[model samples]
Target: MDSFTLNKAAGAVLMVLILTMGVGIVSDIIFEPTIPGEPGYEIVLATPEDSTSEVEPEPDVVPIGERLMAASASAGENVAKKCAACHSFDQGGGNKVGPALWNVMGRKPGGLDGFGYSSAMTAYGEEKPEWTYEGMDNFLAAPKQYISGTSMGFAGLRRPEERADMIAYLRELSENPMPLPGQ
Candidate 1:
């Protein structure tokens, strides 16, 4: 209200602030925090060798032919669903993002005329004339790895059983499915 009263109020606030600052400084000095040279817990990363020791050796993989012997086409159809986005499985099915995979089992890689085939795939076809059971298994296991520069973006089926099933399904897509290996 009055200049004197206002001055007193402002002085009180400034005193409070100063007291707070002083207390903080005193408390900090009294309770000085000690920082460790190293972190509280050291994070030890596993070296390649160390990691290998921890990882169990991969189980013995059954041969693709053996897996195919007991392969189920119905189960294979489900696995093939992943391929549907890129390829058409039906007979006379037109090419989608990838070529129509009808009769692809025995057919040569990159054989479809209308659909553009990557040069790598065409070269692969030149090297391997037809898609044999073992060849298909390897290719399906890792398309890019098998062909190197194949345009097929599918990551590939990891399980041998799934690959075998898929190969079985592809085999059935043909009018005369290639006889199962060793049969």
Candidate 2:
């Protein structure tokens, strides 16, 4: 309307436009769109044009079973400490609150003689076949989950390494040693 009012409004609009442009430029400079899966963004650095050598990494060679056993033995010692109250691996090992875990690797789910297995274990035994390495591994990882209604009160081992080592130690109790992975 008036010259003074129109001049002030125009100056305010110009100031706002300048501030917006300045903020946009600063934002563009500060943040890079290099995150993977985000579109229209890439990250690259300049290098010497003559550099042509490629370095290949050595492939992993250990079998899955061996790796699990190694991880188990290392983690098993610590985890088995929790099982020491009712179980023993030394001579004259007897079932306590739980069955003595000798040769449990390939044995049936509830095969221990003279020990009264819980209904859950019995059911699991009826439903499942002999405990292979993978079977035991899965069972130990989650006993209640594996059997659904077993009476073993102990919580299962959650870590892969602990299950591997515990199985390794149990296999050691047998006259024949269990072979490592890929066998």
Candidate 3:
């Protein structure tokens, strides 16, 4: 072949190789398995099912608010631990660093006796009669946002389901536990 024809052939081959490698690299990056909690990624793997014995499925247990205190499910209890630093759930367990949370789920904000609350909580108390589920949900989602200047230093629970579970757990501690299932 002439020099110019040979050079053109070599350049075409190089271009094809570069394009092929670029596509392969892109595919690898896009298709690689990702581990869970990794930024912008998720991990998924399937394990083979056991073939020896046919195990019976456990009965579905709904977590009622009253039963949450005694039930084995740990979601609500797990979330409740976050409040232990400043609040107490046990009956007659007076205010700690924060007000006693024993029955605060339904009681009015800043209404508990002997507990000195900030102006924010007292202000919320003025307009809000009692802490219902919706009220508690809003408060727990963003404590400071709900009542600015509140003494509660907690940043607040960001997860809706987690807040719900914690509220359900708190309700279980009341003298009259509110009814809730699958909390």
**TM-score winner among the candidates?**
1
Q: Across residues 1-183, which tens digit of lDDT does each residue of candidate 3 receive?
A: 799999999999999999999999999999997667746745664333422111221145222233334443257788888888888878899789998888776688799999999987897798888887666766777787677668889998876567667776777778886555444
Model 2 ranges with Cα > 4 A deviation: 1-66, 72-75
Q: Model 1: per-residue lDDT, tens digit, 71-143?
A: 9988999999999998999889999999999999888888887999999888878887898888888888878
Q: Residue 72 in model 1: shift from native, Å?
A: 0.4
Clashes (candidate 3): 0
lDDT of 3: 0.72
Clashes counted in candidate 1 amount to: 0
Candidate 1 Cα errors over 4 Å, as ranges: 1-59
TM-scores of the candidates are: 0.67, 0.57, 0.57
Model 1 lDDT vs. the true structure?
0.84
lDDT of each: 0.84, 0.68, 0.72
How badly does each model clash, as a count of residue pairs?
0, 5, 0
**Compared to the true structure, candidate 3 yields what TM-score?**
0.57
Candidate 2 local lDDT, 1-183, one digit each (tens): 899999999999999999999999999899865666766757875453633222121144333376464564545666778888977665457888888776666667788887899876876677666676666766676666665656766787766656777777776766665665576
Which residue pairs clash within candidate 2?
72-161, 72-165, 73-165, 120-149, 120-150
